[model samples]
Target: MNRKTFLKTSALASAGILSRPFITYANASKYRVALIGCGWWGTNILREAVASGVVEVVALCDVHEAQIDTCAKELNTWCTDKPKKFKDFRDCIKNAKPDLVINATPDHWHALIAIHALNNGCHVFLEKPIAHTLKEGTAIQKAARANNRICIVDFHRRYSPHNVSGMEFLKSGKVGRIQEVRAFVNYSGNGGKQKPSEPKPADMDWDMYCGPAKLIDYHSGIHPRAWRRQREFANGTLGDWAPHWFDQILWWTEEKAPKKIFSTSTKKIHDNIQTVPENQLVTYEFEDFICFWEHSINNTRPVQQGENVGAYFHGTEGTFHMGWHGGWTFYPHGKNATTIHEDPQLDLPDGQNIKLVWADFLNSIKTGELPHADIEHGRQATNMSLLGMLSNDLGRSIIWDHEKDMVTGDAEANKLLTRDYRGEWVYPS
Candidate 1:
């Protein structure tokens, strides 16, 4: 269904939009965007940003010279000219002087790059899991606030039409009060082990790739996608995927920072890897509701939404299932399950939710309004996953004092909330 038809028939029609618009205080004709991290996802952002028609991509930044060169050449295939390529992020921002930087680097580099971009007086479109650590996430948010800049975290699910409709329906009270939420991700492990340390590739700057984190030996197994499993580089599967699922549930329920969290996990596979869980389960408690999230890299269990990864929200009246692929369904307590339609155009080539997120960011820049997936939303989601990681590490439950934003009465657990950046990288004061 189209947007209008869906809105008119939606249960939330009278309840109002899932996302509230920010008051715009500025005006701009077009935005200049510089993209960092020319990996698979990064290149896609470049294409979509160009397609958005609201920005011009002036620079492509990546530590891997080969990756950035490939991206620049790819852009040349369609456009008459390609963006300038840079190995160092600082140089990209300095020379390009873009109004916005699309940061798709790994989790560890997010905060540092974003803070620098903000220092240069540029807005930022940062990818999920705001930073490698909770402290960095907060710092990134503060930098944006201090600079009076727009920072939109790429929690793409928030821009999903069907997911938005599902949230609206829940808000309308048709399903009664939500009592619990369950999210799951069951995927085959990416791969196993690495090819040991070797000389760094000529086309890559290994030191730059390890920015902010300790410089580990180069290994072929760590690059491309395996980096998600590394503790020092990424947040594992929980950090990589939970942001999307958790972000949806939190936004749907309009909740933040669970009061308590407990989790358990094991590294059944890839024991030699320095990454996170191979399988895990976590439970979070709110004032009136509860949430459960689990994942097994080696299992393909039957899921609530018939999709490998999704969320099921249980309520008094029935249950709501939202898929990562962009569709929602309502299973009434006693009645038959019904499918809900959102904007059908969401399936178009450049009309996917990620593109919509870009559109929202672009609109936010032009109008000086906050994007639908704001930094705070991203921070909450990231914090939730980080809490789960902490619980697993401690082998116990964590009592969260949200107001103070720390783990209560546990010095050791609290210390894990932030990381000590290595080399020249330092947390901004």
Candidate 2:
């Protein structure tokens, strides 16, 4: 950011203190929160964030009436005063004056909405894959730094105690010198087009639903539900859940960005669109180990013996397999079941991890500290996911210059690393 922009933003931030009212101000109300996009994953966020009791749901915004009604009813029951409602997030932010804005919106809206919330002096809780691409993710990192707000990305697996323990095992070299780490995420849903449902409700603004993406038709079924199939709407399953597994991968390695990645996917429906592969197998080269990701939208489980849609740390000692859940098991490196640790009854305060994640953010707000999975953490993780996306697109292995943040072999893939803002939307700071 330029000096002038920094001074202007700092001045504006300082001047915002004068506008606090006894009713809607930050001090009187306990962390008023506005939620944008009430979809499937969004409901999870709404329930968890509301249930956290550290904040109040002051505003609700969704493009669809049914979802809006459903989430609002759930939140209204939890909130003391009726939470304000708006179809557009802009109006919601302007009127409600929330202390925090939680974005469960699609990938495309992540950067724009989160930055806006930060610029408005609201702490932001953003869902993963920080933005659609690397460029936007970097922009968001700068925004978090300049705005100095507690911006936490929802990589909840990172806050899981089991996952943390698993990482500790890797760090301890219990698995010996790590040679390879294989991860898998094969699912049945989240690919292909959906059967057309009835027409969308008249109350819906399909244009706004499209957002920065090029405009198309208004299929109610496609508007919010199967929108994941479209590149403009979602980043498919990779963006959908790779962050969960990647959390384990990155956390275990304690590595930021990998050196290179090459990927291939199932035959695509449209070659022009930047759609994530339905069945992509990405080989990412790291400093110490080679990480293989088996991502598909078809199989329920792994296809190969060494690959079961989980994190596998293959070292000189032994192998460990950990999927989405905390249930992780380890076997002695070369020997058979002589040394295995699988604690089915193990329950080591997973809820405490969640509490710690939020309490850390709240404490960060109080003491200018960066919360767990802060913006840069989100950027690095999201960068890994985007590399997979790019690898799938190119159908070939690609080298990366991490410091400069680009793929060396393909100019075309580099195009997706960043994006031009559609309209007046600017990255904060």
Candidate 3:
């Protein structure tokens, strides 16, 4: 459907309070967007948003000077006014007055940065693994609801046209009822190189990067780039990639959160759960089927996941492997399969989601229309990812009560839901 059609449909689907004529008139052009936490992914988001030509860069903020300067250089390359930059995000939003904030901060800082942005009236685009803790996720959700803002979590896979196609295939009922779901995220490490013992660069603000996470000395193994391996600052292997799967599976399976979870995991011998997991497996149970997923920090190979990481929906009718970005095929029961075509027709129009996602938020600011990955969506995915982490820590199965948002009969595991925030941090009511 075209933009007008979509807006009409969305408006029609929206509720009475949100359907005010003024709300429809609120989505004027010239949107002001800001980027928070200028890192690899954050930079990518900035580049995509800039490439859109629809949004203007009003402000930018990052704790690290190196990142700040690098982004400023790129921003100046195109934007004449040169965006306002700051080390502290609070001051940046307060002063620059952006209408939207793209949060590419570390996972640990996601909830804090996103909540603050929404509370300040800036819509948010938070990168995945929505929060380091369940309470943080819940708090962010509440903040969005209370603040009446739009929040989209940065889940790359879910934005792709292939994801939409994948969901279409599964829900078409051609596959029948899904039976079991299994996924593998193996990146061989040779063991991945150990962190280097390099001196910290003068421009890097290590403390701000480690916000909310326990402070530790700057080490090569767990600094700047390799932080994904660490437990506190980052969500381990499961949280790292599970969002890709959760974003796909839940939408494909037409489900929300899993009913129960159990996992067996530990750091690869020399690695720290604080650093890396040698091998970890998390099994999630839904009402009808179970999802068994594996994480390997040591192996790297192409497309075992198919099309830059994909999934297979096992249905009673047959097995369908969908590589939405690359290709897709179905294996029939008791019949020979044709030589699989590596290149499927994936030549799609330039992905509009980067803009549509932004447009949705801009519209939401005026209209209160939640973007695709709103706070509730973020909370659900965050809860699922954190659940996998707890299953790893508990090393066994735990029942999850969606209503209570807790693990029943497992008090130890339940404690993982919330953590102490910084003394100055104030949560939403």
For lDDT, the strongest prediction is: 1
Instruction: Estimate, for each residue in 45-138, the C-alpha lDDT of model 1 and write its tens digit.
Output: 7666665545666789998988888888777653444468899999999998899899999888999999999989999999988988888998
Clashes of 1: 1
TM-score, candidate 2, is 0.83
Q: List candidate 1 stretches off by more than 4 Å.
A: 1-29, 271-274, 303-305, 335-352
Relative to the true structure, how large is the alpha-carbon lDDT of every model?
0.78, 0.69, 0.68
lDDT of 2 by residue, 1-429 (tens): 233432343334223322212222223446788888887667656655554455777788887777788887666555454678788899999999999888988888888888888888888888887888678887777777788788988766665545555666778877888879888776666433445435667878776776776666665445566666567766777777777677778767667778889777777544222345777777889888898888766667744543345688888888887744335677674435565543322213332233334544565676676766687778887787788887776667778888887778678888767656555555332
Give lDDT: candidate 3, residue 198: 63
Model 2: number of backbone collisions: 3
- Tell me model 1's lDDT, rounded to 2 decimals: 0.78
Stretches of model 3 off by over 4 angstroms after superposition: 1-29, 190-198, 270-274, 300-308, 337-356, 422-429
Candidate 1 TM-score to native: 0.89
Using TM-score as the measure, the top candidate is 1
C-alpha lDDT of residue 127 in model 2: 83
Ranking of predictions according to lDDT:
1, 2, 3
Model 2, which residues run further than 4 Å from truth? Answer: 1-29, 189-198, 268-275, 302-308, 334-336, 342-356, 420-429
